[model samples]
Target chain A: MSPAKHPQRPGGRSARVRDAVYTAVGQLMGEGRPDRLTIPMVAQRAEVNPTSVYRRWGDIDTLLEEVSVAALTREGDEPPDTGSISGDLTQWAQIIVDDITRPQRTRYLRAMVSAREAVESCPCWEQRRGQAKDMLARGIERGEVAPTEHQVLDHVIAPLYHHVVFGLPTDRAYAERLVGDVLAMARPADKA
Target chain B: MSPAKHPQRPGGRSARVRDAVYTAVGQLMGEGRPDRLTIPMVAQRAEVNPTSVYRRWGDIDTLLEEVSVAALTREGDEPPDTGSISGDLTQWAQIIVDDITRPQRTRYLRAMVSAREAVESCPCWEQRRGQAKDMLARGIERGEVAPTEHQVLDHVIAPLYHHVVFGLPTDRAYAERLVGDVLAMARPADKA
Candidate 1:
């Protein structure tokens, strides 16, 4: 197994360096797909010694993992749920649309993709995607979604990452409409 | 730009070389993700000289562009309209699920990702995804999908690619159920 990856500490001399590296990596990812990301450029962008950045993250792949986790984790408060499927989904969809449209989130997605490729055996995406599944499950329990809700989680919310990372624009209104449509589609086949 | 990618070819030696190279690239993609793929192994698989393969394709990235085009083109046989949203989506979703679940398709996704990263400034993915979009659009036009269709296209269909390409064991049933749920969710807010 690969050695466990850790972030540079978030304070003092190390924090300054870590911030620079991540910021640089984000810029590179925003400008191009993950394959084009280079350590030299990342070091240049972050204003850290190339060797130091490499030593800390080990390679582009690991650096990307940190960036992706940070990106998903950094998004601000979710909109309040309206206690109805349409309201809940509309709010969630809008949040996703906003996140992907931001330059940083797309970059993080590209990086996470590279990391997934680099680590062939690990199921690292679960950490990133699990929260979403849990949220959908909550909706299911509240009767806002079907009991068998994993499919909705898999099909709808997750696809936004693929689109954003690939540099596609996913609009907000379209997102809301889709949420409404999907919730409707999931109704039991027998119920009209 | 970039010598006009995938320009139409005259028949003979160039065609033969192109065929051999793409087949080799596709085979390697079928085997595993990009990190695990090697040029020499692709050469061996194609039964062509390694130098010839490299000389012709220039590297894995260019070869991948060709393969991505080929793979995506194979998508979307016409679905029976069946006069209902669920029936149409069920058919289309099944096709996608079945195609992606195959071992070879998994390899192709992994390789295409590597290729996507390596090619710094190409919009090839737009071409690949456009096919799915067009297919979904057709469904929308036929009134087999809801008015807010692109969102459904994004969340439902796009996520399937993410799951399968990332080595998840997703299947057609899962896709159908998700599509169904999304359709249900699409109902007018007041009605829902």
Candidate 2:
């Protein structure tokens, strides 16, 4: 047999382990405690052996690192460029309503919250998050975004996350409203 | 002594136990399995009876919850508004930078990640998140924002969070650049 027996997914054995652990971690995070997340518990739920789990991730935080990366892969949809920046962003902003209400999104968010509590300095956590930021930055470079696009990104969406992860009433309608309001204020003025 | 002793800091009877257990839990989350977080391990490090630990928080999950909240409180800073949207958002975005870089923010994030793994359908989680959205909506009504704010809120700011909580490399310079870029695009236009 090959060194790794498990079937490969998007990123291969490492990916599968990451995916399984994230799924398991997502489930545990929903429960609200690290105590309930035993190796046997994850192995049983993931359909892998405890030995397999240990051989793969070795520990809960390591496993969670994998899980966090997987969560980053899933988020708001890309907006189709409608020739205008406002139109494109308006469409894009609407995507969060869909992202937040989904079951998996909530699970991913909770896991992130719980992980932030224990390991005060974790590189894995930063690496995965970096991917998403790079993705957004790439989008901005391709458009006419403001000088403070990053702040706009921060102020506008941080609350949505605060709402979503914390069990607040964030939804699609709110995202749409936020986008519209900001767009109105952000519209380029015509020269007098 | 009373049926339950409210643990005091510095040299209280339960203080040592609380500190030890809390530290152990943090270490285990970094070095062990989430489910393997047993009371015995906590008690051993705490030097208090396992029974005492159980009496205080009922189980590991409950203990983690309280600790997670406390840890997050320490990582938080009040958002300062500098009047104009430009100044206000600039300050607001930096807070995210500050929070993400703080060591406690990382630990708090880890715990949230673990908890999300256990319970995907936590009602309480949903409720807390809703309040944040409500705050944004209230901001809109207060005219603290222009009418079409949500789109910018959702599209621009949402991504910053992915960067911050994930420990990505988004910074104030990026925030300033984005803010100007988006605000330039947000100005309302006159109809011919």
Clashes of 2: 101
In candidate 1, position A113 carries an lDDT of: 55
DockQ of each model vs. true complex: 0.26, 0.17
Q: Encode model 1's per-residue lDDT on B41-148: one tens digit a residue.
A: 777877667776676677866766666667755664344455566666677677778877776775566555544544654344455345445555666777553634
- Which regions in candidate 1 have their CA more than 4 angstroms from the true location? A1-17, A30-33, A36-60, A77-79, A82-85, A120-152, A166-169, A186-192, B1-21, B24-66, B73-104, B110-156, B166-173, B176-192
Model 2 misplaced stretches (Cα beyond 4 Å): A2-96, A108-167, A189-192, B1-44, B48-65, B75-96, B117-161, B175-192
Interface RMSD for every prediction, one decimal?
5.1, 6.6
Q: Write the per-residue lDDT of candidate 2 for residues B81-142, one digit (tens) a residue.
A: 45455565556556655654555455444444445433334332333234334444555566
Kindly list the per-residue Cα lDDT of model 1 for residues A30-53, writing each as its tens digit: 776565477888887777778777
Q: Which candidate is the best by lDDT?
A: 1
| Per-model TM-score versus the true fold | 0.60, 0.50
Every candidate's CA RMSD: 7.5, 8.6
